[model samples]
Target: MTTPENSTAPRPIKATGRFMLAHPAHIIAQGFGSGLSPVMPGTFGTLFAWLSYVVMTTRWPEIFTPLNWLVITAAGFVVGVWTCQVTGRHLRAPDHGSMVWDEIIAFWLVLVLVTPATLSSQFAAFLVFRFFDMVKPPPISYFDRHLKGGFGVMWDDIVAAFYTLLALALWRAI
Candidate 1:
């Protein structure tokens, strides 16, 4: 597809470490380079989110409380909207697969809500979140198709996170 004459989107370019480092938005929206993975960039972004969550909470328990995590995730989501928008414009692909900040931030939301659990449970959460994200069931698919801009890019994953949490909650209740 060709960008319109009046489009603000830039000419599409390959996502590279050089390009990622060229702008703060690129760095953030690319999941700090995890999005550069040649294979399953979204999965890699989620992995980065899980590992970072573990490291931060474990290494700085005093500062990385659940309350703190709520704040961080909220801030991440807001920042992700802008970063993803800017990066999308630069890439000229509004929802380029390489832009995995949506995955990273969304999985961070999952981790925050399902924490204080065993590694096995966290892995289960990861699997479920990935399933919902990739399958894009119903409204998730709807938003992914109809929403535009950075918010559109990020919203579907938030829905996926909700699905994941709902599944986990049901599992726990059973």
Candidate 2:
């Protein structure tokens, strides 16, 4: 999944200080260290988001409503902008692969959009989101290139999520 947009050249991350238990920003920004994977960290982070979303919705039940998910996603997206900004600055990359708060939260937005989704549909959403995120078509590419800092780091994935939602709606129509 290493595209020019998501270059995989290993950047030397300051592991100890940023990843320490005291660093809440680091923890949230890195998707709890899923981004540290040597391979496909974004994929891992998206999977982590999926599993966490499924678990929370399944276990809590009360907070699984559509309204709640939307509110929660909006809040998380706000936090994610800050997380990506801090981590991107720390890593010195506008959209670093290891700063996977983008992927994790973006996929969560997809999950919320496709709620009550079957396993197949959820899997489809995953593939589509990852594809848009990786390929970054049109405006996605524009945002990725033109935008900077945390919001820029996070915007393309939000665009990808929108694309995924559109795809899902089209799929349902067919």
Candidate 3:
């Protein structure tokens, strides 16, 4: 017997590069397309940020100073807003899953706090940063849900980075 005309399921919405690029905000906020991964997009975005950290630290250690961290964080805040606006408009939804630029910036911030000149130390920092980000304790969760727009997206991760920094500092002290 032939299936009914409506029996076939509707095709899934395919995420397209053109769709992402329709807005300029998405381009910068998504860390230059690192946030566009189909699977585990946040993780992939964070990895991209980590790789950037590695390069920055190795090639331009002088530029990785505290002042530079502040600058980067500020830039992330500005860019994050645009990212949220773009992704929200494109998806017609707030804080879409595919928009992981905030995570990338947050991971990068965390890296600055715990960064060691050694490869092992960097790996340790990465693991610790991921843990805090995923766990989202206290204020981090609060900010994540309550805040709106790009600020909301970036703030939670910043809190997570602070938490990771504190934990790592304590661990090192002990």
| Candidate 2 global TM-score | 0.87
What is the total number of backbone clashes in candidate 3? Answer: 0
Candidate 1, residue 21: CA error in Å?
0.9
* TM-score per candidate: 0.92, 0.87, 0.81
Model 1 accuracy (lDDT, Cα)? 0.91
List the candidate numbers ranked by TM-score, top first. 1, 2, 3
Worst 10 residues of 2 by lDDT: 13-22
Residues 42-103, candidate 2: write the lDDT tens digits.
89889998998889989987977667887877887889889878776666665778778888
Model 1: per-residue Cα lDDT at residue 135: 95
lDDT per residue, candidate 3, 1-174, as tens digits?
Answer: 446565564433345578667777767665667767877667777888889878886789888876797788778778787777667656655666667778777777777766464667767767777777778888888887898876787778878778877887898899
Please give the distance, in angstroms, between residue 151's alpha carbon in candidate 1 and its true position after superposition. Answer: 0.6
Alpha-carbon RMSD to native, per candidate: 3.1, 5.4, 5.8
Best by lDDT: 1
